[model samples]
Target: MKKLLVIGLLTLFITPFAHAQFGVKGGLNVAELTGRDGESASYKAFYHVGVFYQAHLLGPLSIQPEVQYSLQGGNLKSAFTNYDSQLHYLTVPILAKLTVGPVFVEGGPQFGVLLNADQSGNMQVGLAEDGTPAYGNVSRPATGSFKRGDFSLVGGAGLKLASNFSLGARLVAGLNDINDVQNLSGINDPRLQNRVYQVYAAFQFGGGK
Candidate 1:
């Protein structure tokens, strides 16, 4: 992880001499996870802030990458119960941008490292609507930590606003599982997954030749 961070920072510094552009971005996230059975899902709001750099590779094409701090997770509610979880992560996305006239479309892969997670609300063992105790305790023992890497798909669209600036919005969808909970003596079911979606606005500071 440290090595990846170092390489990313180095790329940021060196790219400017090779037709690179830099920018700042902030955005909103609507996060939810897919589940099995007839269970429904809920959404939670998250936020992100980041810096990015891009290098022009050819006419109408460029390689754009970013480093960001993002918040993601969701709230769960079912009939008589409510539970919420929040997660923080360091995320890196590498994208290919395609332009036509004033409009551009981009898509790429993103990597995330979980920084923290917090949970709250009604959390205990009881008879669920299905006549089973879905969860076994108010607080289960924390198992292994969140893994160091999460994969996601990212894509978006925007327009060039000025000679050296542009604005855009993007959606990030998680493609990797993030559950780390282990066996809880046959009472706890690992039903929740850590998948999320985010929308963001970006402001570019430089342009290519």
Candidate 2:
């Protein structure tokens, strides 16, 4: 993880040094985690802020790479309780951008490292007077840290406004499972999956040169 961060930082610094342009971007994200049963957990609104450098490689193509810290997660409401599962990620996406007149299309893979996970809701440990821990259902534990294959796929599109700016949205989808099974027989429920989807709008700075 440290090596990856170092390489990403170096790339960001070197790219701008080569092209001499830098920009700041901030956007909103609609994020959700999907389970294996084909039912989405829930959708939550998150935020993203980052910096990027665009390096021109050819006439119509350029490499736009960014490093962003993003908040992502989902919420679940059942009859017993409601809980929200949130996570923080450091993501790096390197996109190949194409431009034609005033419109542009970009898509690429994103590498993300899990920073943290949080859960907030009615957590019931034991019974008060009537029932066992039945009525008060606590949210399941989120292992938080991901294993070796925590990277995800990211792709999206946007439109250019002026010569120096653009507005666009992208989707980030995780490719790995989020749970680690210690005891197979203890947990028979199969609605566990770690795939996440995020929709975000990006604001580009500096002219595309």
Candidate 3:
């Protein structure tokens, strides 16, 4: 169903703007979490790489479609626990771009399919008499606990750089819950949505009609 939607929309957007340009990009990702209760997850380091198409819809406006492999996650620390989880995703974004010569701004919706999720950290049950975690290390497998699909709103602006090379940045905020973690075992929470700030550079190769 989602796949069909993606294909159908891409065709609709691409067909009208047949004179599109193809490009490749890669960049840094600063990611964090929001919405979950009691979770003070901080921004973590990650990366994203992808390819995109820019189709001119009008004189100064265009429609862009992108496919990306994004590595996104967060760093979480509590009094008795600390860990970092790495999430891998295949993301597709369809953006409406407004261009003014060398400068442009684009905003759109993105859909992500989860590829994998892994966690590395230490967990503890209770503090020792000295006020330290009794069980120092615990492994939490984030698999099967997180949703397989994610949805986000993305917006950004950039320099077109002579129509060949470009530099840009964007923010992506999760609209759907990535993880609804709650347990009778005092385990998880529902506010594990993804938030990422991405800065990238792209090189244009092929020009479309």
Candidate 4:
């Protein structure tokens, strides 16, 4: 299975370079966390930057594979505290695109390797000696709090505004639980999965229809 997986990845990377349009992409990400039982975390804003190679397959069909750096997470708010979880990932998305005139729609699977994670905020730690509650600013490494691998599905549409530039929007839904820590000091949630919406611009180096 490992050998097959490596071979597949190699094919996806190598097949596009022969006759493909290379581009750079950057985007705004609105990310959140969702639970298995319908609970949700507050939305947090983040960003992603990447490069892609789009290989024309058929008349109006193309395959695009991208490598990107993405920051994704969610916010948890209480009466006295606001905790934000920041997750950094190296992500790859393999997409199949269909173009109709100036509009195009794409959908595919995305795999992410977690680079690191951290949480920052002011939250309640414990009670003070005088029978009063105490709060402190917390900033610490949280890489152990999440799973190392993230698998997701992405779908979106865009317009070919010009030959070299395009605008697009996409939705990403996590397929696995990312939370590795069950109960933490500030927040305790069930089955954390990523939910993100992205709006981006793609700049293709060699322009074409």
Q: Give the best candidate by lDDT.
A: 4
When sorted by lDDT, best at the front, the candidate numbers are 4, 3, 1, 2
lDDT of 4 at 113: 98
TM-score ranking from best to worst?
3, 4, 1, 2
Query: How big is the positional error of residue 123 in model 1, measured in Å on the Cα after superposition?
Result: 2.1
Across residues 77-123, which tens digit of lDDT does each residue of candidate 2 receive? 54454667777778888888787887777878878776767767754
Please say which candidate is ahead in TM-score: 2 or 3: 3
Give, for candidate 1, the lowest lDDT window spanning 10 residues.
136-145
Residue 82 lDDT (model 2): 64
Clashing pairs in 2: none
Q: Model 3 over residues 1-209: C-alpha lDDT tens digits?
A: 99999999999876755777888999999998766555468999899999998888778888899999999988877655687888899999999999887888999999999898877787544557976446566555676657899999999999977658888999998998888444413344555789999999989776522
Better-scoring candidate (TM-score), 1 or 3: 3
lDDT (CA) per prediction: 0.71, 0.65, 0.82, 0.87
The count of residue-pair clashes in candidate 4 stands at: 0
Clashes within 3 Å, all models in order: 0, 0, 4, 0
